[model samples]
Target chain A: MKMTKLAALAAATMLAGMPAAWAEGVKVGMITTLSGGGAGLGIDARDGFMLAVKLAGRDDLDVVIEDDQRKPEIAVQLADKMIQSEKVDVLTGIIWSNLAMAVVPAAVAQGKFYLSVNAAPSALAGKGCNPNYFSVSYQNDNLHEAAGAYLAKAGFKKPFILAPNYPAGKDSLTGMKRFYTGELAGEVYTKLGQTDYAAEIAQIRASGADSVFFFLPGGMGISFMKQYADSGVNLPVVGPAFSFDQGILGAVGQAALGVKNTSQWSKDIDNAANKAFVDGFQAEYGRLPSLYAAQGFDTANLLISAMNKADVKDADAFRAALKEADFPSVRGKFSFASNNHPIQDIYVREVVMEGDVITNKIVDTAMTDHANAYVDACKM
Target chain B: MSALLLIEQILNGLQSGVMLFLMAAGLTLVFGVMGLINLAHGSLYMVGAFAAAGAAAATGSFVVALVAALAAAAAAGALIEMLVIRRLYERDHLDQVLATFALILILSEGTRWLFGSFPLYLDVPDWLSGSVTLPGGIQYPLYRLAIIVVGLAVAAGLFGLISRTRLGIRIRAGEADREMIAALGVDISKLYTMVFALGAALAGLAGALVGAIQSVQVGMGEPVLILAFVVIVIGGIGSIKGAFIGALLVGLTETLGGVLLPQLFGLFMDPSAATTVGASLASMAIYILMAVVLIWRPSGLFGVRA
Candidate 1:
């Protein structure tokens, strides 16, 4: 009689559009770089993500976090584990573009939802766009394109441009050129992970450019800014916000002050959602929220918003619910473009001294309702 | 690039060469006095930088930071040399490499645990913050010029210590024949510890100095360590003089290759394509140099024949 009852319940669960499983909640797999050089960004994002999940107070939301060690092969292995054995319904929290590229395509193809907190690489935003994939952050080139627009507006005619010799780096320069209406003084690709920039500094000085633009993220940015400050060329510098993010600004110190960088969000966005996020994040983590942290928070809240409307087991319903994006975003207004990447305002922020703290403040809006250039290429 | 710009780049190369020398000097010394290959030398360098950053944060004195770096790294070096490395002398190179590599992981993890994953701020001193206009109208950073001077001075001092002092004679003797030195009433074990501490101190000093310009963070030492190994290999592992020359060669090849390679390619290819091809090639230039050096003299520039 017990066996027949169990079979009857299973049949009922299958027939009623999975109403019983909604109470059990969804399992989320978060793979991010939690160690090595990029650990600061990942740690902040993780903290912000967990904070939002905690605030939801949903005991049913189960999140499993893993460290990728900022390596691509390790990320692939971890993704395989998350999909095959752990049986996660949703996958998120990848910080680097290369790792996201490696894991996202496969995860979404396997019928699991992949919500990106950071690293919205162009390939996934365009031709590789999948219905199961949703990017909560701006596409990788969004900030760079904004920076290019701002550089032209600020009247930097002969700007020297450079980035690491990699796919994203190439994309960064290309995006910048799309909106930059100037004759480039020089465009040089430096070795990726090359810390010493004295040679590059000398090249910049010799290039006779009116200003400088570069897209070196993380430690590369810190090293370059500090070295550039000492190099004495002192041209006006502009780039994307990755280099000047909150987690890194402290290490760069006063050297980063007065530099203009483009971003999709800043702490001082002047909205109820953003203010709450900034305060809540600081109260929870005891550290300032970075751009990535905001993304993590938004991603978690979006998942929470979707969960309210549909059972995760019902793929069509869940996806449609996610597409609604009913959650109040910290970026004032947020929406998904047809490609599933974000369409939002990109702001120009100047690094400033908030007493002893180094941080950014919004100075200008570079683009309003800026959908990425590759959105048209995305059939999905 | 103009003649003035070229001169500035050459200076940059020289400055980088001297910093690499500081790292290679310690590695070469440790290898020469003891046949143990230490992959953990980079850990000691990292210890120095973290120690300096922590010290600098507390006292706001660059001098205190430097002193703290030297002391902390030397202490750590002595402690490890006694506890782990003393037992490794009897082991083979592979065993020593494995053990030292384990030490690297331990030290790196320990550092991460203590400092967290954020980089510490260690800026150049106020006096050394700006550029100095050198002869021929080249504007160079004062800190880098100071590094060049200090490195050359340290090189001279090391030569004096090795050739002139009684302890130096004993070190050279120990390098030549450790068993003979042990038999001849010399405290061979004590000598080894002193040598190791000395090497560690130099590495610490380098860390503190370069930390001012670079991001002082965990794993900062690993990249520099690779270059140092390349230098020691090119210079002949056991010879300090050779290490210095080898570092300069590597530094110059790397710096000049980055600047000139693109220009060379630009003559035939489009400017953008030239830059792409040139950068890819330039990244390989130093390794190519190492290969050529190895082909001519397998042992190294100053390495004694095996």
Candidate 2:
């Protein structure tokens, strides 16, 4: 009787483990900036992605996460590990453009699908486009262009523009210029990662500009906003969503109030899908989701939707299924452009106090069905 | 630019110089007396910022925050010295480097675990919140001017402590010959601990002071740490006076270069191209200045030949 009971227990354990082994379910490797200066952005993305996967209630799926530490070399090494050792079917989650540039091209070349939650560099959108690469996030310049359009519509003249002296910084200014018709009063490029902006603030005060457009991200943005507020430079301030995201808004505090920014997503986006996501995310993480978090959630849902249609082992079918973009997106209506970047409306958001908590509220739509400048360059 | 703008720029340079001196002074003293290359000094700066931010949030008093920063950093320095760093003093520079680098990773991760990833807020006190006008009709933040004044006062106090006190004599003696000082009945270990704590306190004070203007977050110390090392190298390693002069030079060069380089380039090129070129050059100016100083004096401006 004892032997029979032990055999039954063994059989039950084997039955429980058998399906996961037989299905050969999808394995995903996520590499993101998880520690150091801009860690808040990456942490939010990671939490959002994990929350979506948990909500799916699938036990067969296996996900591996690694911290890139915001370094391109480290990201490359992690990508190699994920591809060669872990044998992940899909790779995603890089926050910085430089790291994305390093990891995405090489990972996609190895025939693994790369879904970008953030860091949509123009290079990959255009000449470097690949069939396996899809960006759920906006192209790096999309929101900046929207801001430019908003400024133009608002009749703001004599704008001063500034960004860090790097590729993305230059890209941001160029994107703004693409839509803004007014002559810039002054254009300055501060040092990347510069903490002190007193000299630059003095310049801005001296320059007779009526408005300021800046693209300083992460800690640089925090420092700039604080100093700008203290400097009493009361001219209207505008920026892309990078600086004004939900994660850093508290750190910016009262300094960011009334500032106008542009993004493809906001918590107050009036849609059922968005309401569910915003409510569910806050319930799960105990914090409001940032734009990066929204992108991450969408990326996870996109993968899950494709997996329902085709097995990742069938690469062609899987790729086609992903391009279909059949999943419900939090952004209301999201479709993939020919280049695999999102073609959706971008909105202007104002930083406002929502009962002692600093957050963004959607004011107006900046652009509808906006496409990137590099789409024409994409052969895929 | 107008003369008033240039004057304001100069003041900005001075303010930056004073802050850099606060960091460089402690670093130079530590290297000078201990002959220990502490790559983890930046971690202490981070600790100070975190402590100050936490204290200020809890107490709502800037004075309490300042005290907490110094005490936390000094205690942390002493504890680290007792546990990990003491074992490393007799080791070679390579081992020291590897150990301290490990400490940086451990401390950064530990801080993250305790504080989470978000940056903390540190506001300037209400009394120091606004700007004051100068003689040239230039507006400068009063808090920044306070930083300049406080930093200079600390420099003076440090100078007096090192040159005119009994503890200062013992420190100099230890620097000159550790064994001889020990033989003269000084508790060398205790003295070492005190000196390390003092240096750490100075670094913490600098971090806490600067935390008001900058985001008080993990990894905030690293950029300042690198600049501080450059200042010490330019001023001559192990020389406080050298660190001060070097820091001022770097600060002035960095601030002025950002303003002037583009204007200078505009003379020969288009305004857009000139701005781009000038900004790039200005970023490189401080390192270039350091390289020039090294070429002129390989041991640095005040460094003694080994």
TM-score of chain B of each: 0.98, 0.97
Worst 10 residues of 1 chain B by lDDT: B214-223
lDDT of 1 by residue, B201-267 (tens): 8888899898888888878888888889999999997788888999899989999999999999999
Pick the DockQ winner.
Answer: 1
True contacts kept of each: 0.73, 0.63
Stretches > 4 Å off in candidate 1? A1-21
Candidate 2: tens digits of C-alpha lDDT, residues A59-99: 66788999999999999999999999999999999999999
Report clash pairs, candidate 1: none
Among incorrect, acceptable, medium and high, the docking class of model 2 is: medium
Report model 2's TM-score to 2 decimal places: 0.96
Q: Report the C-alpha lDDT of model 1 over A135-242, residue by residue, as the tens digit.
A: 998888999999999998988899999999888889999999999967999999998888889988998988889999999987888989999999888899999999
Per-residue lDDT for B166-230 in model 2, tens only?
99998888788889999999998888888888888888998998888888888888889899999
Worst 10 residues of 1 chain A by lDDT: A14-23
TM-score of chain A of each: 0.93, 0.94
Per-model CA lDDT versus the true structure: 0.90, 0.90
